[model samples]
Target: CPPKIITKSATYVYKLSFTALYTVYDVTNDHHMPIRLKDSSNSQKTRLQYASWVGDTNALAMVVENDIYLRQSPSSEEDYRLTFTGEENTLYNGVPDWLYQEEIFKTFEAIWISLDGTYLMFASFNDSKVGQMNFPWFSSNTVLTSDKQNDRFFFPASRQIRYPTAGSHNPEVKLWMAKLSNFSNIEIVELTQPAVILGRNMQKKHQ
Candidate 1:
C-alpha cells in the first residue's frame, strides 16, 4: 500500500507500510522509523519497501498498489473526499502498470497539485486493449467439496496498452489542462499530426 501523506505548512509526514506492518517517516525531520525485517527467524528477511516521493512539496507523487482505485482526501479520518471515475477503458490517473513503467520509461504515472490547499490534476490512462497474464495454484480449502487440494488455473482479463514497438502502430496521444473551480475552464490541445522524430537514420520516428 502507498503511504499516507500528511503535509503541514513546513513538514511532510509519511506513514509507510511493508507487508503487514507500517512505520512513520518524516522528511523535514530527516528521520525514519526503525527498520523491521519481514521474518525475524531468517536473518535475510526482506526489509519493508516503498516508493520515493517525487516533485515539489505542493505537487507530490507516489505509486499505489495492485492497480487499485484512488481518491483524494482532506483528512485521514475521512474517506477519499473526491472520487475519480475515468473513461470506461482507461486507468484512472497514476502510473501505468509494471510493463508500461519499465518498458516505456513512463515512471511517473499521475500528476497532482495543491493549489491553495485544493488538490487537483489530470491523471488517467487507457489500456483496455492490453493483453492478460495468468497463473495456476492449488486451493487450500473448498467449501463445496471435501477435497482440500483442488487444482485450478485462471487467466484474468487485462488490457494491451497499445505499446509502440520499433515499428508498430502507435495510439494517438492527446493532452488537456483544466482548472478546479466553479465555472472552471478546460483546454484540450489536439495534435493533428502525431509527433515525429527528425534525425539522420531515425528521421521518421513517431512518439
Candidate 2:
C-alpha cells in the first residue's frame, strides 16, 4: 500500500500580504475568515511586520515597526505595547538585526513565548554605532549613456547597510521579559548576562 497521507485540520494559517503586511486566517470556521486587529487602521496595519498565536492559546504576539505588541485574546480590542525604543533600522525589538541574522542567529525573529503562555521574552538590538556599507543598485532595464568626453553616467543611488567589520563596534543586545495579563499594567524586566560572559572589560565599561 502506498504511504497513507493523512492531513490534519489547521486552526490558523499565517501569511504575508503583498503590501508586506501580516495576516492570519482561521480555518476552523466554514468561511475561513481572516483574524483582524481590533484597530485595523491602514496606518496600523501597514506598520505590522508579523503576528503569531501564543502557545496553545488565542492570544496574539506581534511586531509592528520593530516593536512588540500583545493582545490577550483574538477578539480583544486592547493591544498592549511592549517596548518603546524600536527605531526602524537602528534599534529592533522582538526581531534580530542584520548582524544577528547574517552572523549570529540566522533567523528573522528573536521572540520567545513561555510554554504556559504566561510570559513573553524577547531580544532588543541596538546597531546605532555599527559601521555602514553602501551598495549601488541598478535595474535590469536601466539604460547607460556615454558623453562626448567618453564618460559613462547612470543614476546616482546607493543602499546603505549597517555592517560590523572585524574588531569594530558590535550591536548591543539585551533580553527583556514581561508578564501577560488582561490588564494594562505590564512591566518589562531586563535580564542580565552572566558574570563570566561580562568579563572585566564589560564590567569596567558599565562602571
Off by over 4 Å in 2: 1-19, 32-44, 138-156, 196-207
Which 10 residues in a row give candidate 2 its minimum summed lDDT? 10-19
Candidate 1, 116-194: lDDT as tens digits? 5233343345555544334332333323344324544343333333344555433333333333332123222322334
Q: Put down candidate 2 lDDT per residue, 86-199, tens digits, no spaces.
A: 987799898788778667786667899887777888999999999999977555424454452554566756767789999999999999988876438977799987778779
Worst 10 residues of 1 by lDDT: 8-17
Top model by TM-score, which number? 2
Q: Which portions of model 1 show Cα errors greater than 4 Å?
A: 1-83, 86-90, 106-108, 112-121, 133-207
Residue pairs in steric clash, candidate 2? none
